[model samples]
Target: MAEARETLEEPILTGNGGPTDLAAMEPDLLDVEPDQTVASGRRRRSFQFGWWLACGWLILVVGAALLAPILPLWEPGTPDYTNVAGGLSASHPLGGDAIGRDNLSRLIYGARASLLVGLSAVVLGAVIGGLLGIIAGYVGGKVERVLLTLTDATLAFPGLVLLIAAVAVFGASMTVIIVGLAVLSIPTFIRLARATTLVIVQREFVTAARAYGARPMRVMLREVVPNVVLPVAAYGFIMVGVFIVAEGSLSFLGLGIPPPTPSWGSMIAAGRTELLTHPQISLIPAAVMFVTVLSINYVGERTRKRFEVKDSNL
Candidate 1:
Protein backbone atom coordinates (compact mmCIF):
# COMPACT_ATOMS: atom_id res chain seq x y z
CA MET A 1 0.00 0.00 0.00
CA ALA A 2 2.90 2.38 0.78
CA GLU A 3 4.48 1.61 -2.62
CA ALA A 4 1.13 2.13 -4.37
CA ARG A 5 0.53 5.47 -2.63
CA GLU A 6 4.05 6.64 -3.48
CA THR A 7 3.54 5.66 -7.11
CA LEU A 8 0.32 7.65 -7.20
CA GLU A 9 2.02 10.74 -5.80
CA GLU A 10 4.91 10.62 -8.32
CA PRO A 11 4.77 13.30 -11.01
CA ILE A 12 3.38 11.95 -14.26
CA LEU A 13 5.67 12.71 -17.18
CA THR A 14 4.92 12.85 -20.92
CA GLY A 15 7.21 13.43 -23.86
CA ASN A 16 5.64 16.81 -24.63
CA GLY A 17 4.98 18.02 -21.09
CA GLY A 18 6.44 21.50 -21.49
CA PRO A 19 4.00 24.37 -20.89
CA THR A 20 4.69 25.97 -24.27
CA ASP A 21 3.84 22.80 -26.15
CA LEU A 22 0.69 22.16 -24.10
CA ALA A 23 -0.56 25.70 -24.61
CA ALA A 24 0.03 25.66 -28.36
CA MET A 25 -1.64 22.26 -28.58
CA GLU A 26 -4.65 23.11 -26.44
CA PRO A 27 -5.35 26.83 -25.97
CA ASP A 28 -8.87 26.01 -24.82
CA LEU A 29 -7.35 24.56 -21.66
CA LEU A 30 -7.19 28.05 -20.27
CA ASP A 31 -10.71 28.85 -21.39
CA VAL A 32 -12.25 25.77 -19.75
CA GLU A 33 -10.69 25.88 -16.27
CA PRO A 34 -8.06 27.79 -14.35
CA ASP A 35 -4.76 26.20 -13.43
CA GLN A 36 -2.44 28.16 -11.17
CA THR A 37 0.74 26.16 -11.51
CA VAL A 38 3.88 27.85 -12.89
CA ALA A 39 3.83 25.37 -15.79
CA SER A 40 0.23 26.28 -16.55
CA GLY A 41 1.08 29.99 -16.58
CA ARG A 42 3.85 29.31 -19.08
CA ARG A 43 1.34 27.34 -21.13
CA ARG A 44 -1.10 30.23 -21.07
CA ARG A 45 1.61 32.55 -22.38
CA SER A 46 2.34 30.29 -25.37
CA PHE A 47 -1.31 29.90 -26.32
CA GLN A 48 -2.43 28.84 -29.85
CA PHE A 49 -3.12 32.11 -31.63
CA GLY A 50 -3.58 30.35 -34.98
CA TRP A 51 -6.29 28.10 -33.58
CA TRP A 52 -8.20 31.08 -32.24
CA LEU A 53 -8.14 32.80 -35.61
CA ALA A 54 -9.48 29.69 -37.31
CA CYS A 55 -12.14 29.12 -34.65
CA GLY A 56 -13.27 32.74 -34.85
CA TRP A 57 -13.73 32.52 -38.62
CA LEU A 58 -15.69 29.30 -38.22
CA ILE A 59 -17.95 30.86 -35.62
CA LEU A 60 -18.61 33.84 -37.86
CA VAL A 61 -19.56 31.69 -40.86
CA VAL A 62 -21.68 29.34 -38.76
CA GLY A 63 -23.42 32.26 -37.10
CA ALA A 64 -24.23 33.69 -40.50
CA ALA A 65 -25.55 30.34 -41.65
CA LEU A 66 -27.77 29.78 -38.59
CA LEU A 67 -29.19 33.30 -38.57
CA ALA A 68 -29.66 33.60 -42.34
CA PRO A 69 -33.34 32.63 -42.54
CA ILE A 70 -34.41 34.75 -39.57
CA LEU A 71 -32.69 37.89 -40.85
CA PRO A 72 -34.15 40.08 -43.60
CA LEU A 73 -31.67 38.73 -46.14
CA TRP A 74 -32.21 39.27 -49.87
CA GLU A 75 -33.87 36.58 -51.95
CA PRO A 76 -31.30 34.18 -53.51
CA GLY A 77 -33.14 32.85 -56.58
CA THR A 78 -35.07 35.93 -57.56
CA PRO A 79 -33.73 36.89 -60.96
CA ASP A 80 -32.77 40.47 -61.84
CA TYR A 81 -32.01 40.18 -65.54
CA THR A 82 -30.59 43.74 -65.61
CA ASN A 83 -28.08 42.87 -62.90
CA VAL A 84 -27.00 39.62 -64.50
CA ALA A 85 -23.24 39.36 -64.00
CA GLY A 86 -23.26 42.74 -62.21
CA GLY A 87 -20.19 43.77 -60.27
CA LEU A 88 -20.24 44.55 -56.52
CA SER A 89 -22.69 47.41 -56.02
CA ALA A 90 -24.45 49.34 -53.23
CA SER A 91 -27.57 47.17 -53.50
CA HIS A 92 -25.80 43.88 -54.43
CA PRO A 93 -22.78 43.80 -52.14
CA LEU A 94 -21.27 40.70 -53.78
CA GLY A 95 -23.10 41.24 -57.09
CA GLY A 96 -25.65 39.17 -59.00
CA ASP A 97 -25.60 35.59 -60.27
CA ALA A 98 -26.34 34.48 -63.89
CA ILE A 99 -30.04 35.19 -63.53
CA GLY A 100 -29.68 38.16 -61.07
CA ARG A 101 -30.22 36.59 -57.62
CA ASP A 102 -28.47 38.46 -54.81
CA ASN A 103 -24.95 37.12 -54.34
CA LEU A 104 -24.95 37.57 -50.57
CA SER A 105 -28.26 35.83 -50.17
CA ARG A 106 -27.17 32.85 -52.28
CA LEU A 107 -23.99 32.43 -50.28
CA ILE A 108 -25.84 32.77 -46.99
CA TYR A 109 -28.48 30.23 -47.97
CA GLY A 110 -25.85 28.02 -49.58
CA ALA A 111 -24.27 27.63 -46.15
CA ARG A 112 -27.37 25.78 -45.00
CA ALA A 113 -27.00 23.24 -47.81
CA SER A 114 -23.28 22.60 -47.42
CA LEU A 115 -23.19 22.62 -43.61
CA LEU A 116 -26.46 20.75 -43.27
CA VAL A 117 -25.35 18.00 -45.65
CA GLY A 118 -21.94 17.73 -44.02
CA LEU A 119 -23.26 17.48 -40.47
CA SER A 120 -26.12 15.10 -41.28
CA ALA A 121 -23.94 12.77 -43.32
CA VAL A 122 -21.24 12.59 -40.68
CA VAL A 123 -23.72 11.90 -37.87
CA LEU A 124 -25.53 9.21 -39.85
CA GLY A 125 -22.33 7.44 -40.83
CA ALA A 126 -20.76 7.78 -37.40
CA VAL A 127 -23.68 6.33 -35.51
CA ILE A 128 -23.99 3.22 -37.64
CA GLY A 129 -20.28 2.71 -38.29
CA GLY A 130 -19.24 3.39 -34.72
CA LEU A 131 -21.70 0.83 -33.38
CA LEU A 132 -20.75 -1.82 -35.92
CA GLY A 133 -17.04 -1.24 -35.31
CA ILE A 134 -17.40 -1.54 -31.55
CA ILE A 135 -19.28 -4.80 -31.94
CA ALA A 136 -16.75 -6.22 -34.37
CA GLY A 137 -13.73 -5.21 -32.28
CA TYR A 138 -15.19 -6.47 -28.99
CA VAL A 139 -16.89 -9.64 -30.18
CA GLY A 140 -14.45 -10.92 -32.83
CA GLY A 141 -15.07 -14.19 -34.85
CA LYS A 142 -17.71 -14.18 -37.60
CA VAL A 143 -18.96 -10.73 -36.70
CA GLU A 144 -15.56 -9.18 -37.33
CA ARG A 145 -15.27 -10.94 -40.68
CA VAL A 146 -18.68 -9.74 -41.79
CA LEU A 147 -18.16 -6.18 -40.65
CA LEU A 148 -14.67 -5.82 -42.13
CA THR A 149 -15.77 -7.23 -45.44
CA LEU A 150 -18.63 -4.80 -45.72
CA THR A 151 -16.43 -1.85 -44.83
CA ASP A 152 -13.76 -2.91 -47.29
CA ALA A 153 -16.27 -3.36 -50.08
CA THR A 154 -17.56 0.15 -49.67
CA LEU A 155 -14.01 1.47 -49.66
CA ALA A 156 -13.03 -0.29 -52.88
CA PHE A 157 -14.86 2.03 -55.27
CA PRO A 158 -13.56 5.47 -56.29
CA GLY A 159 -15.35 7.93 -54.01
CA LEU A 160 -16.39 10.43 -56.70
CA VAL A 161 -17.69 7.75 -59.02
CA LEU A 162 -19.64 6.20 -56.20
CA LEU A 163 -21.22 9.53 -55.32
CA ILE A 164 -22.10 10.34 -58.90
CA ALA A 165 -23.56 6.91 -59.45
CA ALA A 166 -25.61 7.09 -56.28
CA VAL A 167 -26.97 10.50 -57.17
CA ALA A 168 -27.67 9.38 -60.72
CA VAL A 169 -29.62 6.38 -59.52
CA PHE A 170 -31.38 8.01 -56.57
CA GLY A 171 -31.89 11.44 -58.19
CA ALA A 172 -30.17 14.68 -57.08
CA SER A 173 -32.44 15.53 -54.17
CA MET A 174 -30.88 16.81 -50.91
CA THR A 175 -31.90 13.68 -49.04
CA VAL A 176 -30.29 11.49 -51.69
CA ILE A 177 -27.11 13.53 -51.57
CA ILE A 178 -26.95 13.21 -47.77
CA VAL A 179 -27.58 9.47 -47.96
CA GLY A 180 -24.93 8.99 -50.61
CA LEU A 181 -22.32 10.93 -48.67
CA ALA A 182 -23.16 9.00 -45.49
CA VAL A 183 -22.76 5.69 -47.30
CA LEU A 184 -19.28 6.64 -48.51
CA SER A 185 -18.26 7.94 -45.10
CA ILE A 186 -19.30 4.90 -43.07
CA PRO A 187 -16.31 2.78 -44.10
CA THR A 188 -13.86 5.35 -42.75
CA PHE A 189 -15.66 5.61 -39.42
CA ILE A 190 -15.85 1.82 -39.18
CA ARG A 191 -12.11 1.42 -39.67
CA LEU A 192 -11.29 4.23 -37.26
CA ALA A 193 -13.62 2.99 -34.54
CA ARG A 194 -12.45 -0.59 -35.01
CA ALA A 195 -8.79 0.32 -34.62
CA THR A 196 -9.46 2.46 -31.54
CA THR A 197 -11.66 -0.23 -30.00
CA LEU A 198 -9.08 -2.93 -30.68
CA VAL A 199 -6.51 -0.93 -28.73
CA ILE A 200 -8.93 -0.19 -25.86
CA VAL A 201 -10.30 -3.73 -25.57
CA GLN A 202 -6.86 -4.98 -24.48
CA ARG A 203 -6.68 -2.44 -21.66
CA GLU A 204 -7.03 -3.52 -18.03
CA PHE A 205 -10.37 -1.82 -17.35
CA VAL A 206 -11.99 -3.75 -20.15
CA THR A 207 -10.43 -6.98 -18.99
CA ALA A 208 -11.67 -6.30 -15.47
CA ALA A 209 -15.20 -5.67 -16.74
CA ARG A 210 -15.19 -9.03 -18.52
CA ALA A 211 -13.72 -10.77 -15.51
CA TYR A 212 -16.53 -9.40 -13.36
CA GLY A 213 -19.01 -11.04 -15.78
CA ALA A 214 -20.50 -7.78 -17.00
CA ARG A 215 -22.88 -8.29 -19.90
CA PRO A 216 -21.09 -7.97 -23.21
CA MET A 217 -23.33 -5.12 -24.42
CA ARG A 218 -22.91 -3.33 -21.10
CA VAL A 219 -19.14 -3.64 -21.24
CA MET A 220 -18.99 -2.62 -24.86
CA LEU A 221 -21.25 0.41 -24.40
CA ARG A 222 -20.13 1.60 -20.99
CA GLU A 223 -16.45 0.72 -21.05
CA VAL A 224 -15.40 0.67 -24.68
CA VAL A 225 -17.49 3.33 -26.48
CA PRO A 226 -16.75 6.16 -24.05
CA ASN A 227 -13.01 5.60 -24.32
CA VAL A 228 -12.96 5.27 -28.11
CA VAL A 229 -15.40 8.05 -29.07
CA LEU A 230 -13.18 11.11 -28.59
CA PRO A 231 -10.85 10.45 -31.49
CA VAL A 232 -13.75 9.45 -33.72
CA ALA A 233 -15.54 12.70 -32.93
CA ALA A 234 -12.46 14.77 -33.70
CA TYR A 235 -12.15 12.94 -36.98
CA GLY A 236 -15.82 13.63 -37.60
CA PHE A 237 -15.18 17.40 -37.44
CA ILE A 238 -12.60 17.03 -40.17
CA MET A 239 -14.85 14.77 -42.21
CA VAL A 240 -17.61 17.39 -42.17
CA GLY A 241 -15.43 19.60 -44.33
CA VAL A 242 -14.72 16.76 -46.71
CA PHE A 243 -18.42 16.08 -47.05
CA ILE A 244 -19.03 19.77 -47.71
CA VAL A 245 -16.47 19.82 -50.49
CA ALA A 246 -17.85 16.61 -51.93
CA GLU A 247 -21.38 17.99 -51.96
CA GLY A 248 -20.12 21.11 -53.65
CA SER A 249 -18.34 19.03 -56.28
CA LEU A 250 -21.51 17.10 -57.00
CA SER A 251 -23.39 20.35 -57.42
CA PHE A 252 -20.71 21.73 -59.72
CA LEU A 253 -20.99 18.66 -61.93
CA GLY A 254 -24.77 19.20 -62.10
CA LEU A 255 -25.25 16.00 -60.13
CA GLY A 256 -26.44 17.61 -56.91
CA ILE A 257 -29.35 19.98 -56.27
CA PRO A 258 -30.70 21.57 -59.42
CA PRO A 259 -30.10 25.14 -60.47
CA PRO A 260 -31.64 28.08 -58.47
CA THR A 261 -30.78 26.23 -55.22
CA PRO A 262 -27.82 28.56 -54.45
CA SER A 263 -25.33 25.81 -53.56
CA TRP A 264 -21.73 26.99 -53.53
CA GLY A 265 -20.88 24.62 -56.35
CA SER A 266 -23.84 25.73 -58.42
CA MET A 267 -22.82 29.34 -57.78
CA ILE A 268 -19.37 28.64 -59.14
CA ALA A 269 -20.83 26.84 -62.12
CA ALA A 270 -23.14 29.76 -62.89
CA GLY A 271 -20.37 32.31 -62.52
CA ARG A 272 -17.93 30.36 -64.70
CA THR A 273 -19.91 31.33 -67.82
CA GLU A 274 -19.15 34.99 -67.08
CA LEU A 275 -15.75 34.32 -65.48
CA LEU A 276 -13.86 36.80 -67.67
CA THR A 277 -16.61 39.43 -67.32
CA HIS A 278 -17.41 39.43 -63.60
CA PRO A 279 -15.05 37.14 -61.68
CA GLN A 280 -16.30 38.15 -58.22
CA ILE A 281 -19.54 36.22 -58.60
CA SER A 282 -17.68 32.90 -58.70
CA LEU A 283 -14.76 34.06 -56.59
CA ILE A 284 -16.88 35.13 -53.61
CA PRO A 285 -18.58 31.78 -53.06
CA ALA A 286 -15.34 29.94 -53.72
CA ALA A 287 -13.61 32.03 -51.07
CA VAL A 288 -16.29 31.25 -48.53
CA MET A 289 -15.97 27.52 -49.19
CA PHE A 290 -12.19 27.68 -48.93
CA VAL A 291 -12.25 29.57 -45.64
CA THR A 292 -14.91 27.34 -44.10
CA VAL A 293 -13.04 24.15 -45.04
CA LEU A 294 -9.75 25.51 -43.75
CA SER A 295 -11.29 26.46 -40.40
CA ILE A 296 -12.79 22.99 -39.95
CA ASN A 297 -9.41 21.39 -40.69
CA TYR A 298 -7.62 23.57 -38.15
CA VAL A 299 -10.15 22.77 -35.42
CA GLY A 300 -9.98 19.06 -36.28
CA GLU A 301 -6.17 18.95 -36.21
CA ARG A 302 -5.94 20.62 -32.81
CA THR A 303 -8.63 18.38 -31.38
CA ARG A 304 -6.86 15.30 -32.72
CA LYS A 305 -3.53 16.28 -31.15
CA ARG A 306 -5.17 17.13 -27.81
CA PHE A 307 -6.88 13.73 -27.53
CA GLU A 308 -3.77 11.92 -28.69
CA VAL A 309 -1.95 13.41 -25.70
CA LYS A 310 -4.81 12.37 -23.43
CA ASP A 311 -4.72 8.77 -24.69
CA SER A 312 -0.95 8.65 -24.29
CA ASN A 313 -1.26 9.73 -20.66
CA LEU A 314 -3.81 7.02 -19.99
Candidate 2:
Protein backbone atom coordinates (compact mmCIF):
# COMPACT_ATOMS: atom_id res chain seq x y z
CA MET A 1 0.00 0.00 0.00
CA ALA A 2 2.90 2.38 0.89
CA GLU A 3 4.70 1.65 -2.39
CA ALA A 4 1.53 2.34 -4.46
CA ARG A 5 0.92 5.61 -2.56
CA GLU A 6 4.55 6.73 -3.15
CA THR A 7 4.20 6.10 -6.91
CA LEU A 8 0.89 7.95 -7.08
CA GLU A 9 2.17 10.94 -5.06
CA GLU A 10 5.32 11.35 -7.19
CA PRO A 11 5.33 14.89 -8.66
CA ILE A 12 3.84 15.00 -12.15
CA LEU A 13 6.01 16.98 -14.55
CA THR A 14 4.19 20.32 -14.88
CA GLY A 15 5.88 23.19 -16.68
CA ASN A 16 7.49 25.33 -13.94
CA GLY A 17 5.29 23.40 -11.45
CA GLY A 18 2.67 26.13 -11.82
CA PRO A 19 -1.11 25.84 -12.17
CA THR A 20 -0.90 27.96 -15.38
CA ASP A 21 1.07 25.06 -16.94
CA LEU A 22 -2.23 23.17 -17.18
CA ALA A 23 -3.37 25.72 -19.76
CA ALA A 24 -0.23 25.01 -21.82
CA MET A 25 -1.04 21.26 -21.87
CA GLU A 26 -4.42 21.79 -23.44
CA PRO A 27 -4.95 20.07 -26.84
CA ASP A 28 -4.78 22.39 -29.87
CA LEU A 29 -3.17 25.14 -27.83
CA LEU A 30 -2.71 26.95 -31.15
CA ASP A 31 -6.08 28.23 -32.27
CA VAL A 32 -7.32 26.51 -35.42
CA GLU A 33 -10.74 28.20 -35.46
CA PRO A 34 -9.50 31.07 -37.56
CA ASP A 35 -7.97 28.69 -40.10
CA GLN A 36 -11.27 26.78 -40.26
CA THR A 37 -13.18 30.02 -40.79
CA VAL A 38 -10.79 31.01 -43.57
CA ALA A 39 -11.30 27.68 -45.28
CA SER A 40 -15.07 27.96 -45.01
CA GLY A 41 -15.00 31.48 -46.39
CA ARG A 42 -12.98 30.32 -49.39
CA ARG A 43 -15.46 27.49 -49.97
CA ARG A 44 -18.38 29.91 -49.88
CA ARG A 45 -16.67 32.21 -52.36
CA SER A 46 -16.01 29.36 -54.76
CA PHE A 47 -19.63 28.23 -54.52
CA GLN A 48 -20.89 31.74 -55.23
CA PHE A 49 -18.66 32.14 -58.27
CA GLY A 50 -19.71 28.77 -59.63
CA TRP A 51 -23.39 29.45 -59.10
CA TRP A 52 -23.12 32.87 -60.69
CA LEU A 53 -21.50 31.51 -63.83
CA ALA A 54 -24.03 28.70 -64.16
CA CYS A 55 -27.03 30.89 -63.48
CA GLY A 56 -25.79 33.64 -65.78
CA TRP A 57 -25.58 31.26 -68.71
CA LEU A 58 -29.00 29.81 -67.92
CA ILE A 59 -30.58 33.25 -67.77
CA LEU A 60 -28.99 34.26 -71.04
CA VAL A 61 -30.34 31.20 -72.79
CA VAL A 62 -33.80 31.73 -71.32
CA GLY A 63 -33.81 35.41 -72.19
CA ALA A 64 -32.85 34.66 -75.77
CA ALA A 65 -35.67 32.17 -76.05
CA LEU A 66 -38.26 34.43 -74.48
CA LEU A 67 -37.27 37.44 -76.57
CA ALA A 68 -37.26 35.49 -79.83
CA PRO A 69 -41.04 35.24 -80.14
CA ILE A 70 -42.17 38.51 -78.55
CA LEU A 71 -39.79 41.04 -80.09
CA PRO A 72 -41.12 42.52 -83.40
CA LEU A 73 -37.45 42.54 -84.43
CA TRP A 74 -38.36 41.83 -88.08
CA GLU A 75 -40.98 40.44 -90.40
CA PRO A 76 -40.09 36.96 -91.74
CA GLY A 77 -41.11 37.13 -95.43
CA THR A 78 -41.09 40.90 -96.12
CA PRO A 79 -37.92 41.61 -98.04
CA ASP A 80 -36.40 45.09 -97.90
CA TYR A 81 -37.59 45.77 -101.48
CA THR A 82 -35.57 48.97 -101.59
CA ASN A 83 -31.98 47.71 -101.91
CA VAL A 84 -30.63 51.28 -102.41
CA ALA A 85 -31.49 52.03 -98.79
CA GLY A 86 -29.08 49.76 -96.82
CA GLY A 87 -27.25 49.93 -93.52
CA LEU A 88 -28.77 50.12 -90.00
CA SER A 89 -31.63 52.60 -90.02
CA ALA A 90 -34.58 53.08 -87.66
CA SER A 91 -36.82 51.05 -90.00
CA HIS A 92 -34.18 48.34 -90.58
CA PRO A 93 -32.02 47.97 -87.46
CA LEU A 94 -29.81 45.12 -88.78
CA GLY A 95 -30.53 46.05 -92.42
CA GLY A 96 -32.15 43.64 -94.87
CA ASP A 97 -30.96 40.40 -96.51
CA ALA A 98 -30.22 40.26 -100.26
CA ILE A 99 -33.87 39.36 -100.95
CA GLY A 100 -35.02 42.31 -98.74
CA ARG A 101 -36.17 40.13 -95.81
CA ASP A 102 -35.44 41.82 -92.49
CA ASN A 103 -32.11 40.43 -91.25
CA LEU A 104 -32.93 41.10 -87.62
CA SER A 105 -36.32 39.36 -87.88
CA ARG A 106 -34.90 36.32 -89.67
CA LEU A 107 -32.13 36.16 -87.11
CA ILE A 108 -34.56 36.18 -84.23
CA TYR A 109 -36.76 33.50 -85.83
CA GLY A 110 -33.68 31.50 -86.84
CA ALA A 111 -32.81 31.12 -83.19
CA ARG A 112 -35.82 28.88 -82.78
CA ALA A 113 -34.57 26.42 -85.41
CA SER A 114 -30.96 26.55 -84.26
CA LEU A 115 -31.85 25.97 -80.61
CA LEU A 116 -34.31 23.23 -81.48
CA VAL A 117 -31.77 21.24 -83.47
CA GLY A 118 -29.11 21.70 -80.82
CA LEU A 119 -31.33 20.56 -77.94
CA SER A 120 -32.89 17.67 -79.85
CA ALA A 121 -29.56 16.34 -81.02
CA VAL A 122 -28.17 16.53 -77.48
CA VAL A 123 -31.10 14.64 -75.99
CA LEU A 124 -31.00 11.93 -78.63
CA GLY A 125 -27.24 11.55 -78.43
CA ALA A 126 -27.18 11.47 -74.64
CA VAL A 127 -29.93 8.89 -74.32
CA ILE A 128 -28.63 6.51 -76.96
CA GLY A 129 -24.93 6.94 -76.26
CA GLY A 130 -25.26 7.06 -72.48
CA LEU A 131 -27.33 3.86 -72.33
CA LEU A 132 -25.03 1.93 -74.64
CA GLY A 133 -21.97 3.18 -72.81
CA ILE A 134 -23.34 2.29 -69.38
CA ILE A 135 -24.27 -1.19 -70.54
CA ALA A 136 -20.91 -1.76 -72.17
CA GLY A 137 -19.01 -0.58 -69.11
CA TYR A 138 -21.02 -2.56 -66.57
CA VAL A 139 -21.20 -5.80 -68.56
CA GLY A 140 -17.67 -6.75 -69.35
CA GLY A 141 -16.17 -9.71 -71.27
CA LYS A 142 -17.73 -10.29 -74.73
CA VAL A 143 -20.31 -7.54 -74.40
CA GLU A 144 -17.82 -4.87 -73.48
CA ARG A 145 -15.45 -5.95 -76.20
CA VAL A 146 -18.17 -5.86 -78.83
CA LEU A 147 -19.61 -2.47 -77.83
CA LEU A 148 -16.20 -0.81 -77.52
CA THR A 149 -15.16 -2.18 -80.90
CA LEU A 150 -18.30 -0.72 -82.45
CA THR A 151 -17.72 2.60 -80.74
CA ASP A 152 -14.15 2.69 -82.02
CA ALA A 153 -15.32 1.98 -85.53
CA THR A 154 -17.91 4.75 -85.37
CA LEU A 155 -15.42 7.26 -83.92
CA ALA A 156 -12.86 6.53 -86.64
CA PHE A 157 -14.86 8.47 -89.22
CA PRO A 158 -14.70 12.26 -89.11
CA GLY A 159 -17.89 13.88 -87.79
CA LEU A 160 -18.22 16.39 -90.64
CA VAL A 161 -17.66 13.69 -93.21
CA LEU A 162 -20.40 11.56 -91.67
CA LEU A 163 -22.74 14.53 -91.59
CA ILE A 164 -22.04 15.30 -95.22
CA ALA A 165 -22.64 11.70 -96.21
CA ALA A 166 -25.95 11.59 -94.33
CA VAL A 167 -27.12 14.86 -95.83
CA ALA A 168 -26.30 13.55 -99.29
CA VAL A 169 -28.37 10.41 -98.78
CA PHE A 170 -31.30 11.65 -96.70
CA GLY A 171 -31.64 15.23 -98.05
CA ALA A 172 -31.61 18.28 -95.76
CA SER A 173 -34.64 18.39 -93.51
CA MET A 174 -34.75 19.25 -89.79
CA THR A 175 -35.31 15.60 -88.94
CA VAL A 176 -32.43 14.46 -91.14
CA ILE A 177 -30.16 17.14 -89.67
CA ILE A 178 -30.99 16.16 -86.12
CA VAL A 179 -30.55 12.46 -86.89
CA GLY A 180 -27.22 13.04 -88.62
CA LEU A 181 -25.86 15.22 -85.84
CA ALA A 182 -27.03 12.86 -83.10
CA VAL A 183 -25.54 9.85 -84.86
CA LEU A 184 -22.24 11.62 -85.40
CA SER A 185 -22.16 12.69 -81.72
CA ILE A 186 -22.97 9.30 -80.21
CA PRO A 187 -19.45 7.80 -80.11
CA THR A 188 -18.15 10.67 -77.97
CA PHE A 189 -20.86 10.27 -75.35
CA ILE A 190 -20.38 6.52 -75.40
CA ARG A 191 -16.72 6.88 -74.51
CA LEU A 192 -17.43 9.49 -71.85
CA ALA A 193 -20.16 7.45 -70.16
CA ARG A 194 -18.16 4.24 -70.36
CA ALA A 195 -15.10 5.84 -68.78
CA THR A 196 -17.18 7.34 -65.97
CA THR A 197 -18.89 4.01 -65.34
CA LEU A 198 -15.58 2.17 -65.19
CA VAL A 199 -14.39 4.41 -62.34
CA ILE A 200 -17.71 4.61 -60.49
CA VAL A 201 -18.42 0.87 -60.48
CA GLN A 202 -15.29 0.24 -58.46
CA ARG A 203 -16.07 2.77 -55.71
CA GLU A 204 -16.65 1.53 -52.12
CA PHE A 205 -20.09 3.17 -51.96
CA VAL A 206 -21.20 1.11 -54.95
CA THR A 207 -19.98 -2.02 -53.22
CA ALA A 208 -21.66 -1.00 -50.00
CA ALA A 209 -24.90 -0.36 -51.84
CA ARG A 210 -24.63 -3.72 -53.51
CA ALA A 211 -23.96 -5.41 -50.20
CA TYR A 212 -27.18 -3.97 -48.90
CA GLY A 213 -29.10 -5.83 -51.65
CA ALA A 214 -29.62 -2.79 -53.86
CA ARG A 215 -30.62 -3.85 -57.34
CA PRO A 216 -28.36 -3.21 -60.31
CA MET A 217 -30.65 -0.58 -61.80
CA ARG A 218 -30.93 1.20 -58.45
CA VAL A 219 -27.19 1.17 -58.00
CA MET A 220 -26.70 2.57 -61.47
CA LEU A 221 -29.51 5.13 -61.63
CA ARG A 222 -29.54 6.36 -58.03
CA GLU A 223 -25.91 5.97 -57.03
CA VAL A 224 -23.69 5.88 -60.10
CA VAL A 225 -25.57 7.95 -62.70
CA PRO A 226 -26.23 11.03 -60.56
CA ASN A 227 -22.53 11.38 -59.80
CA VAL A 228 -21.54 11.08 -63.46
CA VAL A 229 -24.22 13.35 -64.99
CA LEU A 230 -22.59 16.72 -64.31
CA PRO A 231 -19.75 16.02 -66.73
CA VAL A 232 -22.22 14.72 -69.29
CA ALA A 233 -24.36 17.84 -68.93
CA ALA A 234 -21.32 20.05 -69.40
CA TYR A 235 -20.41 18.08 -72.50
CA GLY A 236 -23.96 18.47 -73.78
CA PHE A 237 -23.70 22.27 -73.61
CA ILE A 238 -20.46 22.14 -75.60
CA MET A 239 -22.11 19.89 -78.17
CA VAL A 240 -24.98 22.37 -78.70
CA GLY A 241 -22.64 24.72 -80.53
CA VAL A 242 -21.29 21.90 -82.63
CA PHE A 243 -24.76 20.88 -83.73
CA ILE A 244 -25.72 24.47 -84.55
CA VAL A 245 -22.60 24.91 -86.66
CA ALA A 246 -23.10 21.59 -88.39
CA GLU A 247 -26.66 22.47 -89.31
CA GLY A 248 -25.52 25.83 -90.61
CA SER A 249 -22.76 24.23 -92.64
CA LEU A 250 -25.20 21.80 -94.20
CA SER A 251 -27.54 24.68 -95.05
CA PHE A 252 -24.65 26.66 -96.49
CA LEU A 253 -23.97 23.67 -98.76
CA GLY A 254 -27.57 24.09 -100.07
CA LEU A 255 -28.95 21.03 -98.32
CA GLY A 256 -30.40 22.15 -94.96
CA ILE A 257 -33.63 23.46 -93.29
CA PRO A 258 -35.35 24.03 -96.68
CA PRO A 259 -36.11 27.33 -98.45
CA PRO A 260 -38.80 29.85 -97.30
CA THR A 261 -38.05 28.81 -93.72
CA PRO A 262 -35.46 31.27 -92.39
CA SER A 263 -32.56 29.27 -90.93
CA TRP A 264 -29.31 31.00 -89.97
CA GLY A 265 -27.49 28.57 -92.22
CA SER A 266 -29.84 29.29 -95.10
CA MET A 267 -29.41 33.02 -94.51
CA ILE A 268 -25.64 32.69 -94.65
CA ALA A 269 -25.96 30.66 -97.83
CA ALA A 270 -28.19 33.30 -99.36
CA GLY A 271 -25.72 36.05 -98.48
CA ARG A 272 -22.73 34.16 -99.92
CA THR A 273 -23.77 35.08 -103.47
CA GLU A 274 -23.66 38.79 -102.62
CA LEU A 275 -20.87 38.49 -100.07
CA LEU A 276 -18.75 41.17 -101.74
CA THR A 277 -21.62 43.48 -102.71
CA HIS A 278 -24.04 43.25 -99.73
CA PRO A 279 -21.71 41.90 -97.03
CA GLN A 280 -24.12 42.75 -94.24
CA ILE A 281 -26.48 39.91 -95.25
CA SER A 282 -23.88 37.22 -94.59
CA LEU A 283 -21.99 39.21 -91.95
CA ILE A 284 -25.00 39.71 -89.67
CA PRO A 285 -25.94 36.00 -89.50
CA ALA A 286 -22.29 35.00 -89.18
CA ALA A 287 -21.92 37.41 -86.29
CA VAL A 288 -24.93 35.94 -84.52
CA MET A 289 -23.60 32.42 -85.02
CA PHE A 290 -20.19 33.46 -83.74
CA VAL A 291 -21.60 35.09 -80.62
CA THR A 292 -23.96 32.21 -79.88
CA VAL A 293 -21.27 29.57 -80.27
CA LEU A 294 -18.74 31.58 -78.29
CA SER A 295 -21.15 32.12 -75.42
CA ILE A 296 -21.99 28.41 -75.33
CA ASN A 297 -18.34 27.38 -75.26
CA TYR A 298 -17.56 29.87 -72.51
CA VAL A 299 -20.46 28.58 -70.44
CA GLY A 300 -19.35 24.98 -70.95
CA GLU A 301 -15.79 25.77 -69.91
CA ARG A 302 -17.03 27.56 -66.80
CA THR A 303 -19.31 24.64 -65.98
CA ARG A 304 -16.45 22.18 -66.29
CA LYS A 305 -14.29 24.30 -63.97
CA ARG A 306 -17.10 24.57 -61.46
CA PHE A 307 -17.61 20.81 -61.46
CA GLU A 308 -13.90 20.17 -61.08
CA VAL A 309 -13.77 22.55 -58.12
CA LYS A 310 -16.86 20.94 -56.59
CA ASP A 311 -15.40 17.48 -56.95
CA SER A 312 -12.17 18.65 -55.30
CA ASN A 313 -14.16 20.04 -52.39
CA LEU A 314 -15.91 16.69 -51.99
How does model 2 fare in lDDT? 0.79
Off by over 4 Å in 2: 1-62, 83-85
Give the 10-residue window scoring lowest on summed lDDT in candidate 2.
Answer: 29-38
lDDT of 1 by residue, 216-302 (tens): 889988999998788889989999999889888888898987766778888887788888878888899999999999999988988
CA error at residue 289 for candidate 2, angstroms: 1.1
Question: Roughly what TM-score does model 2 have, to 2 decimal places?
Answer: 0.80
| C-alpha lDDT of candidate 1 relative to the true structure | 0.83
Q: Model 2, 16-113: lDDT tens per residue? A: 66554444434333332233433467777876776676567556654765587677666677766883326787888888877677877787778778
lDDT of each: 0.83, 0.79
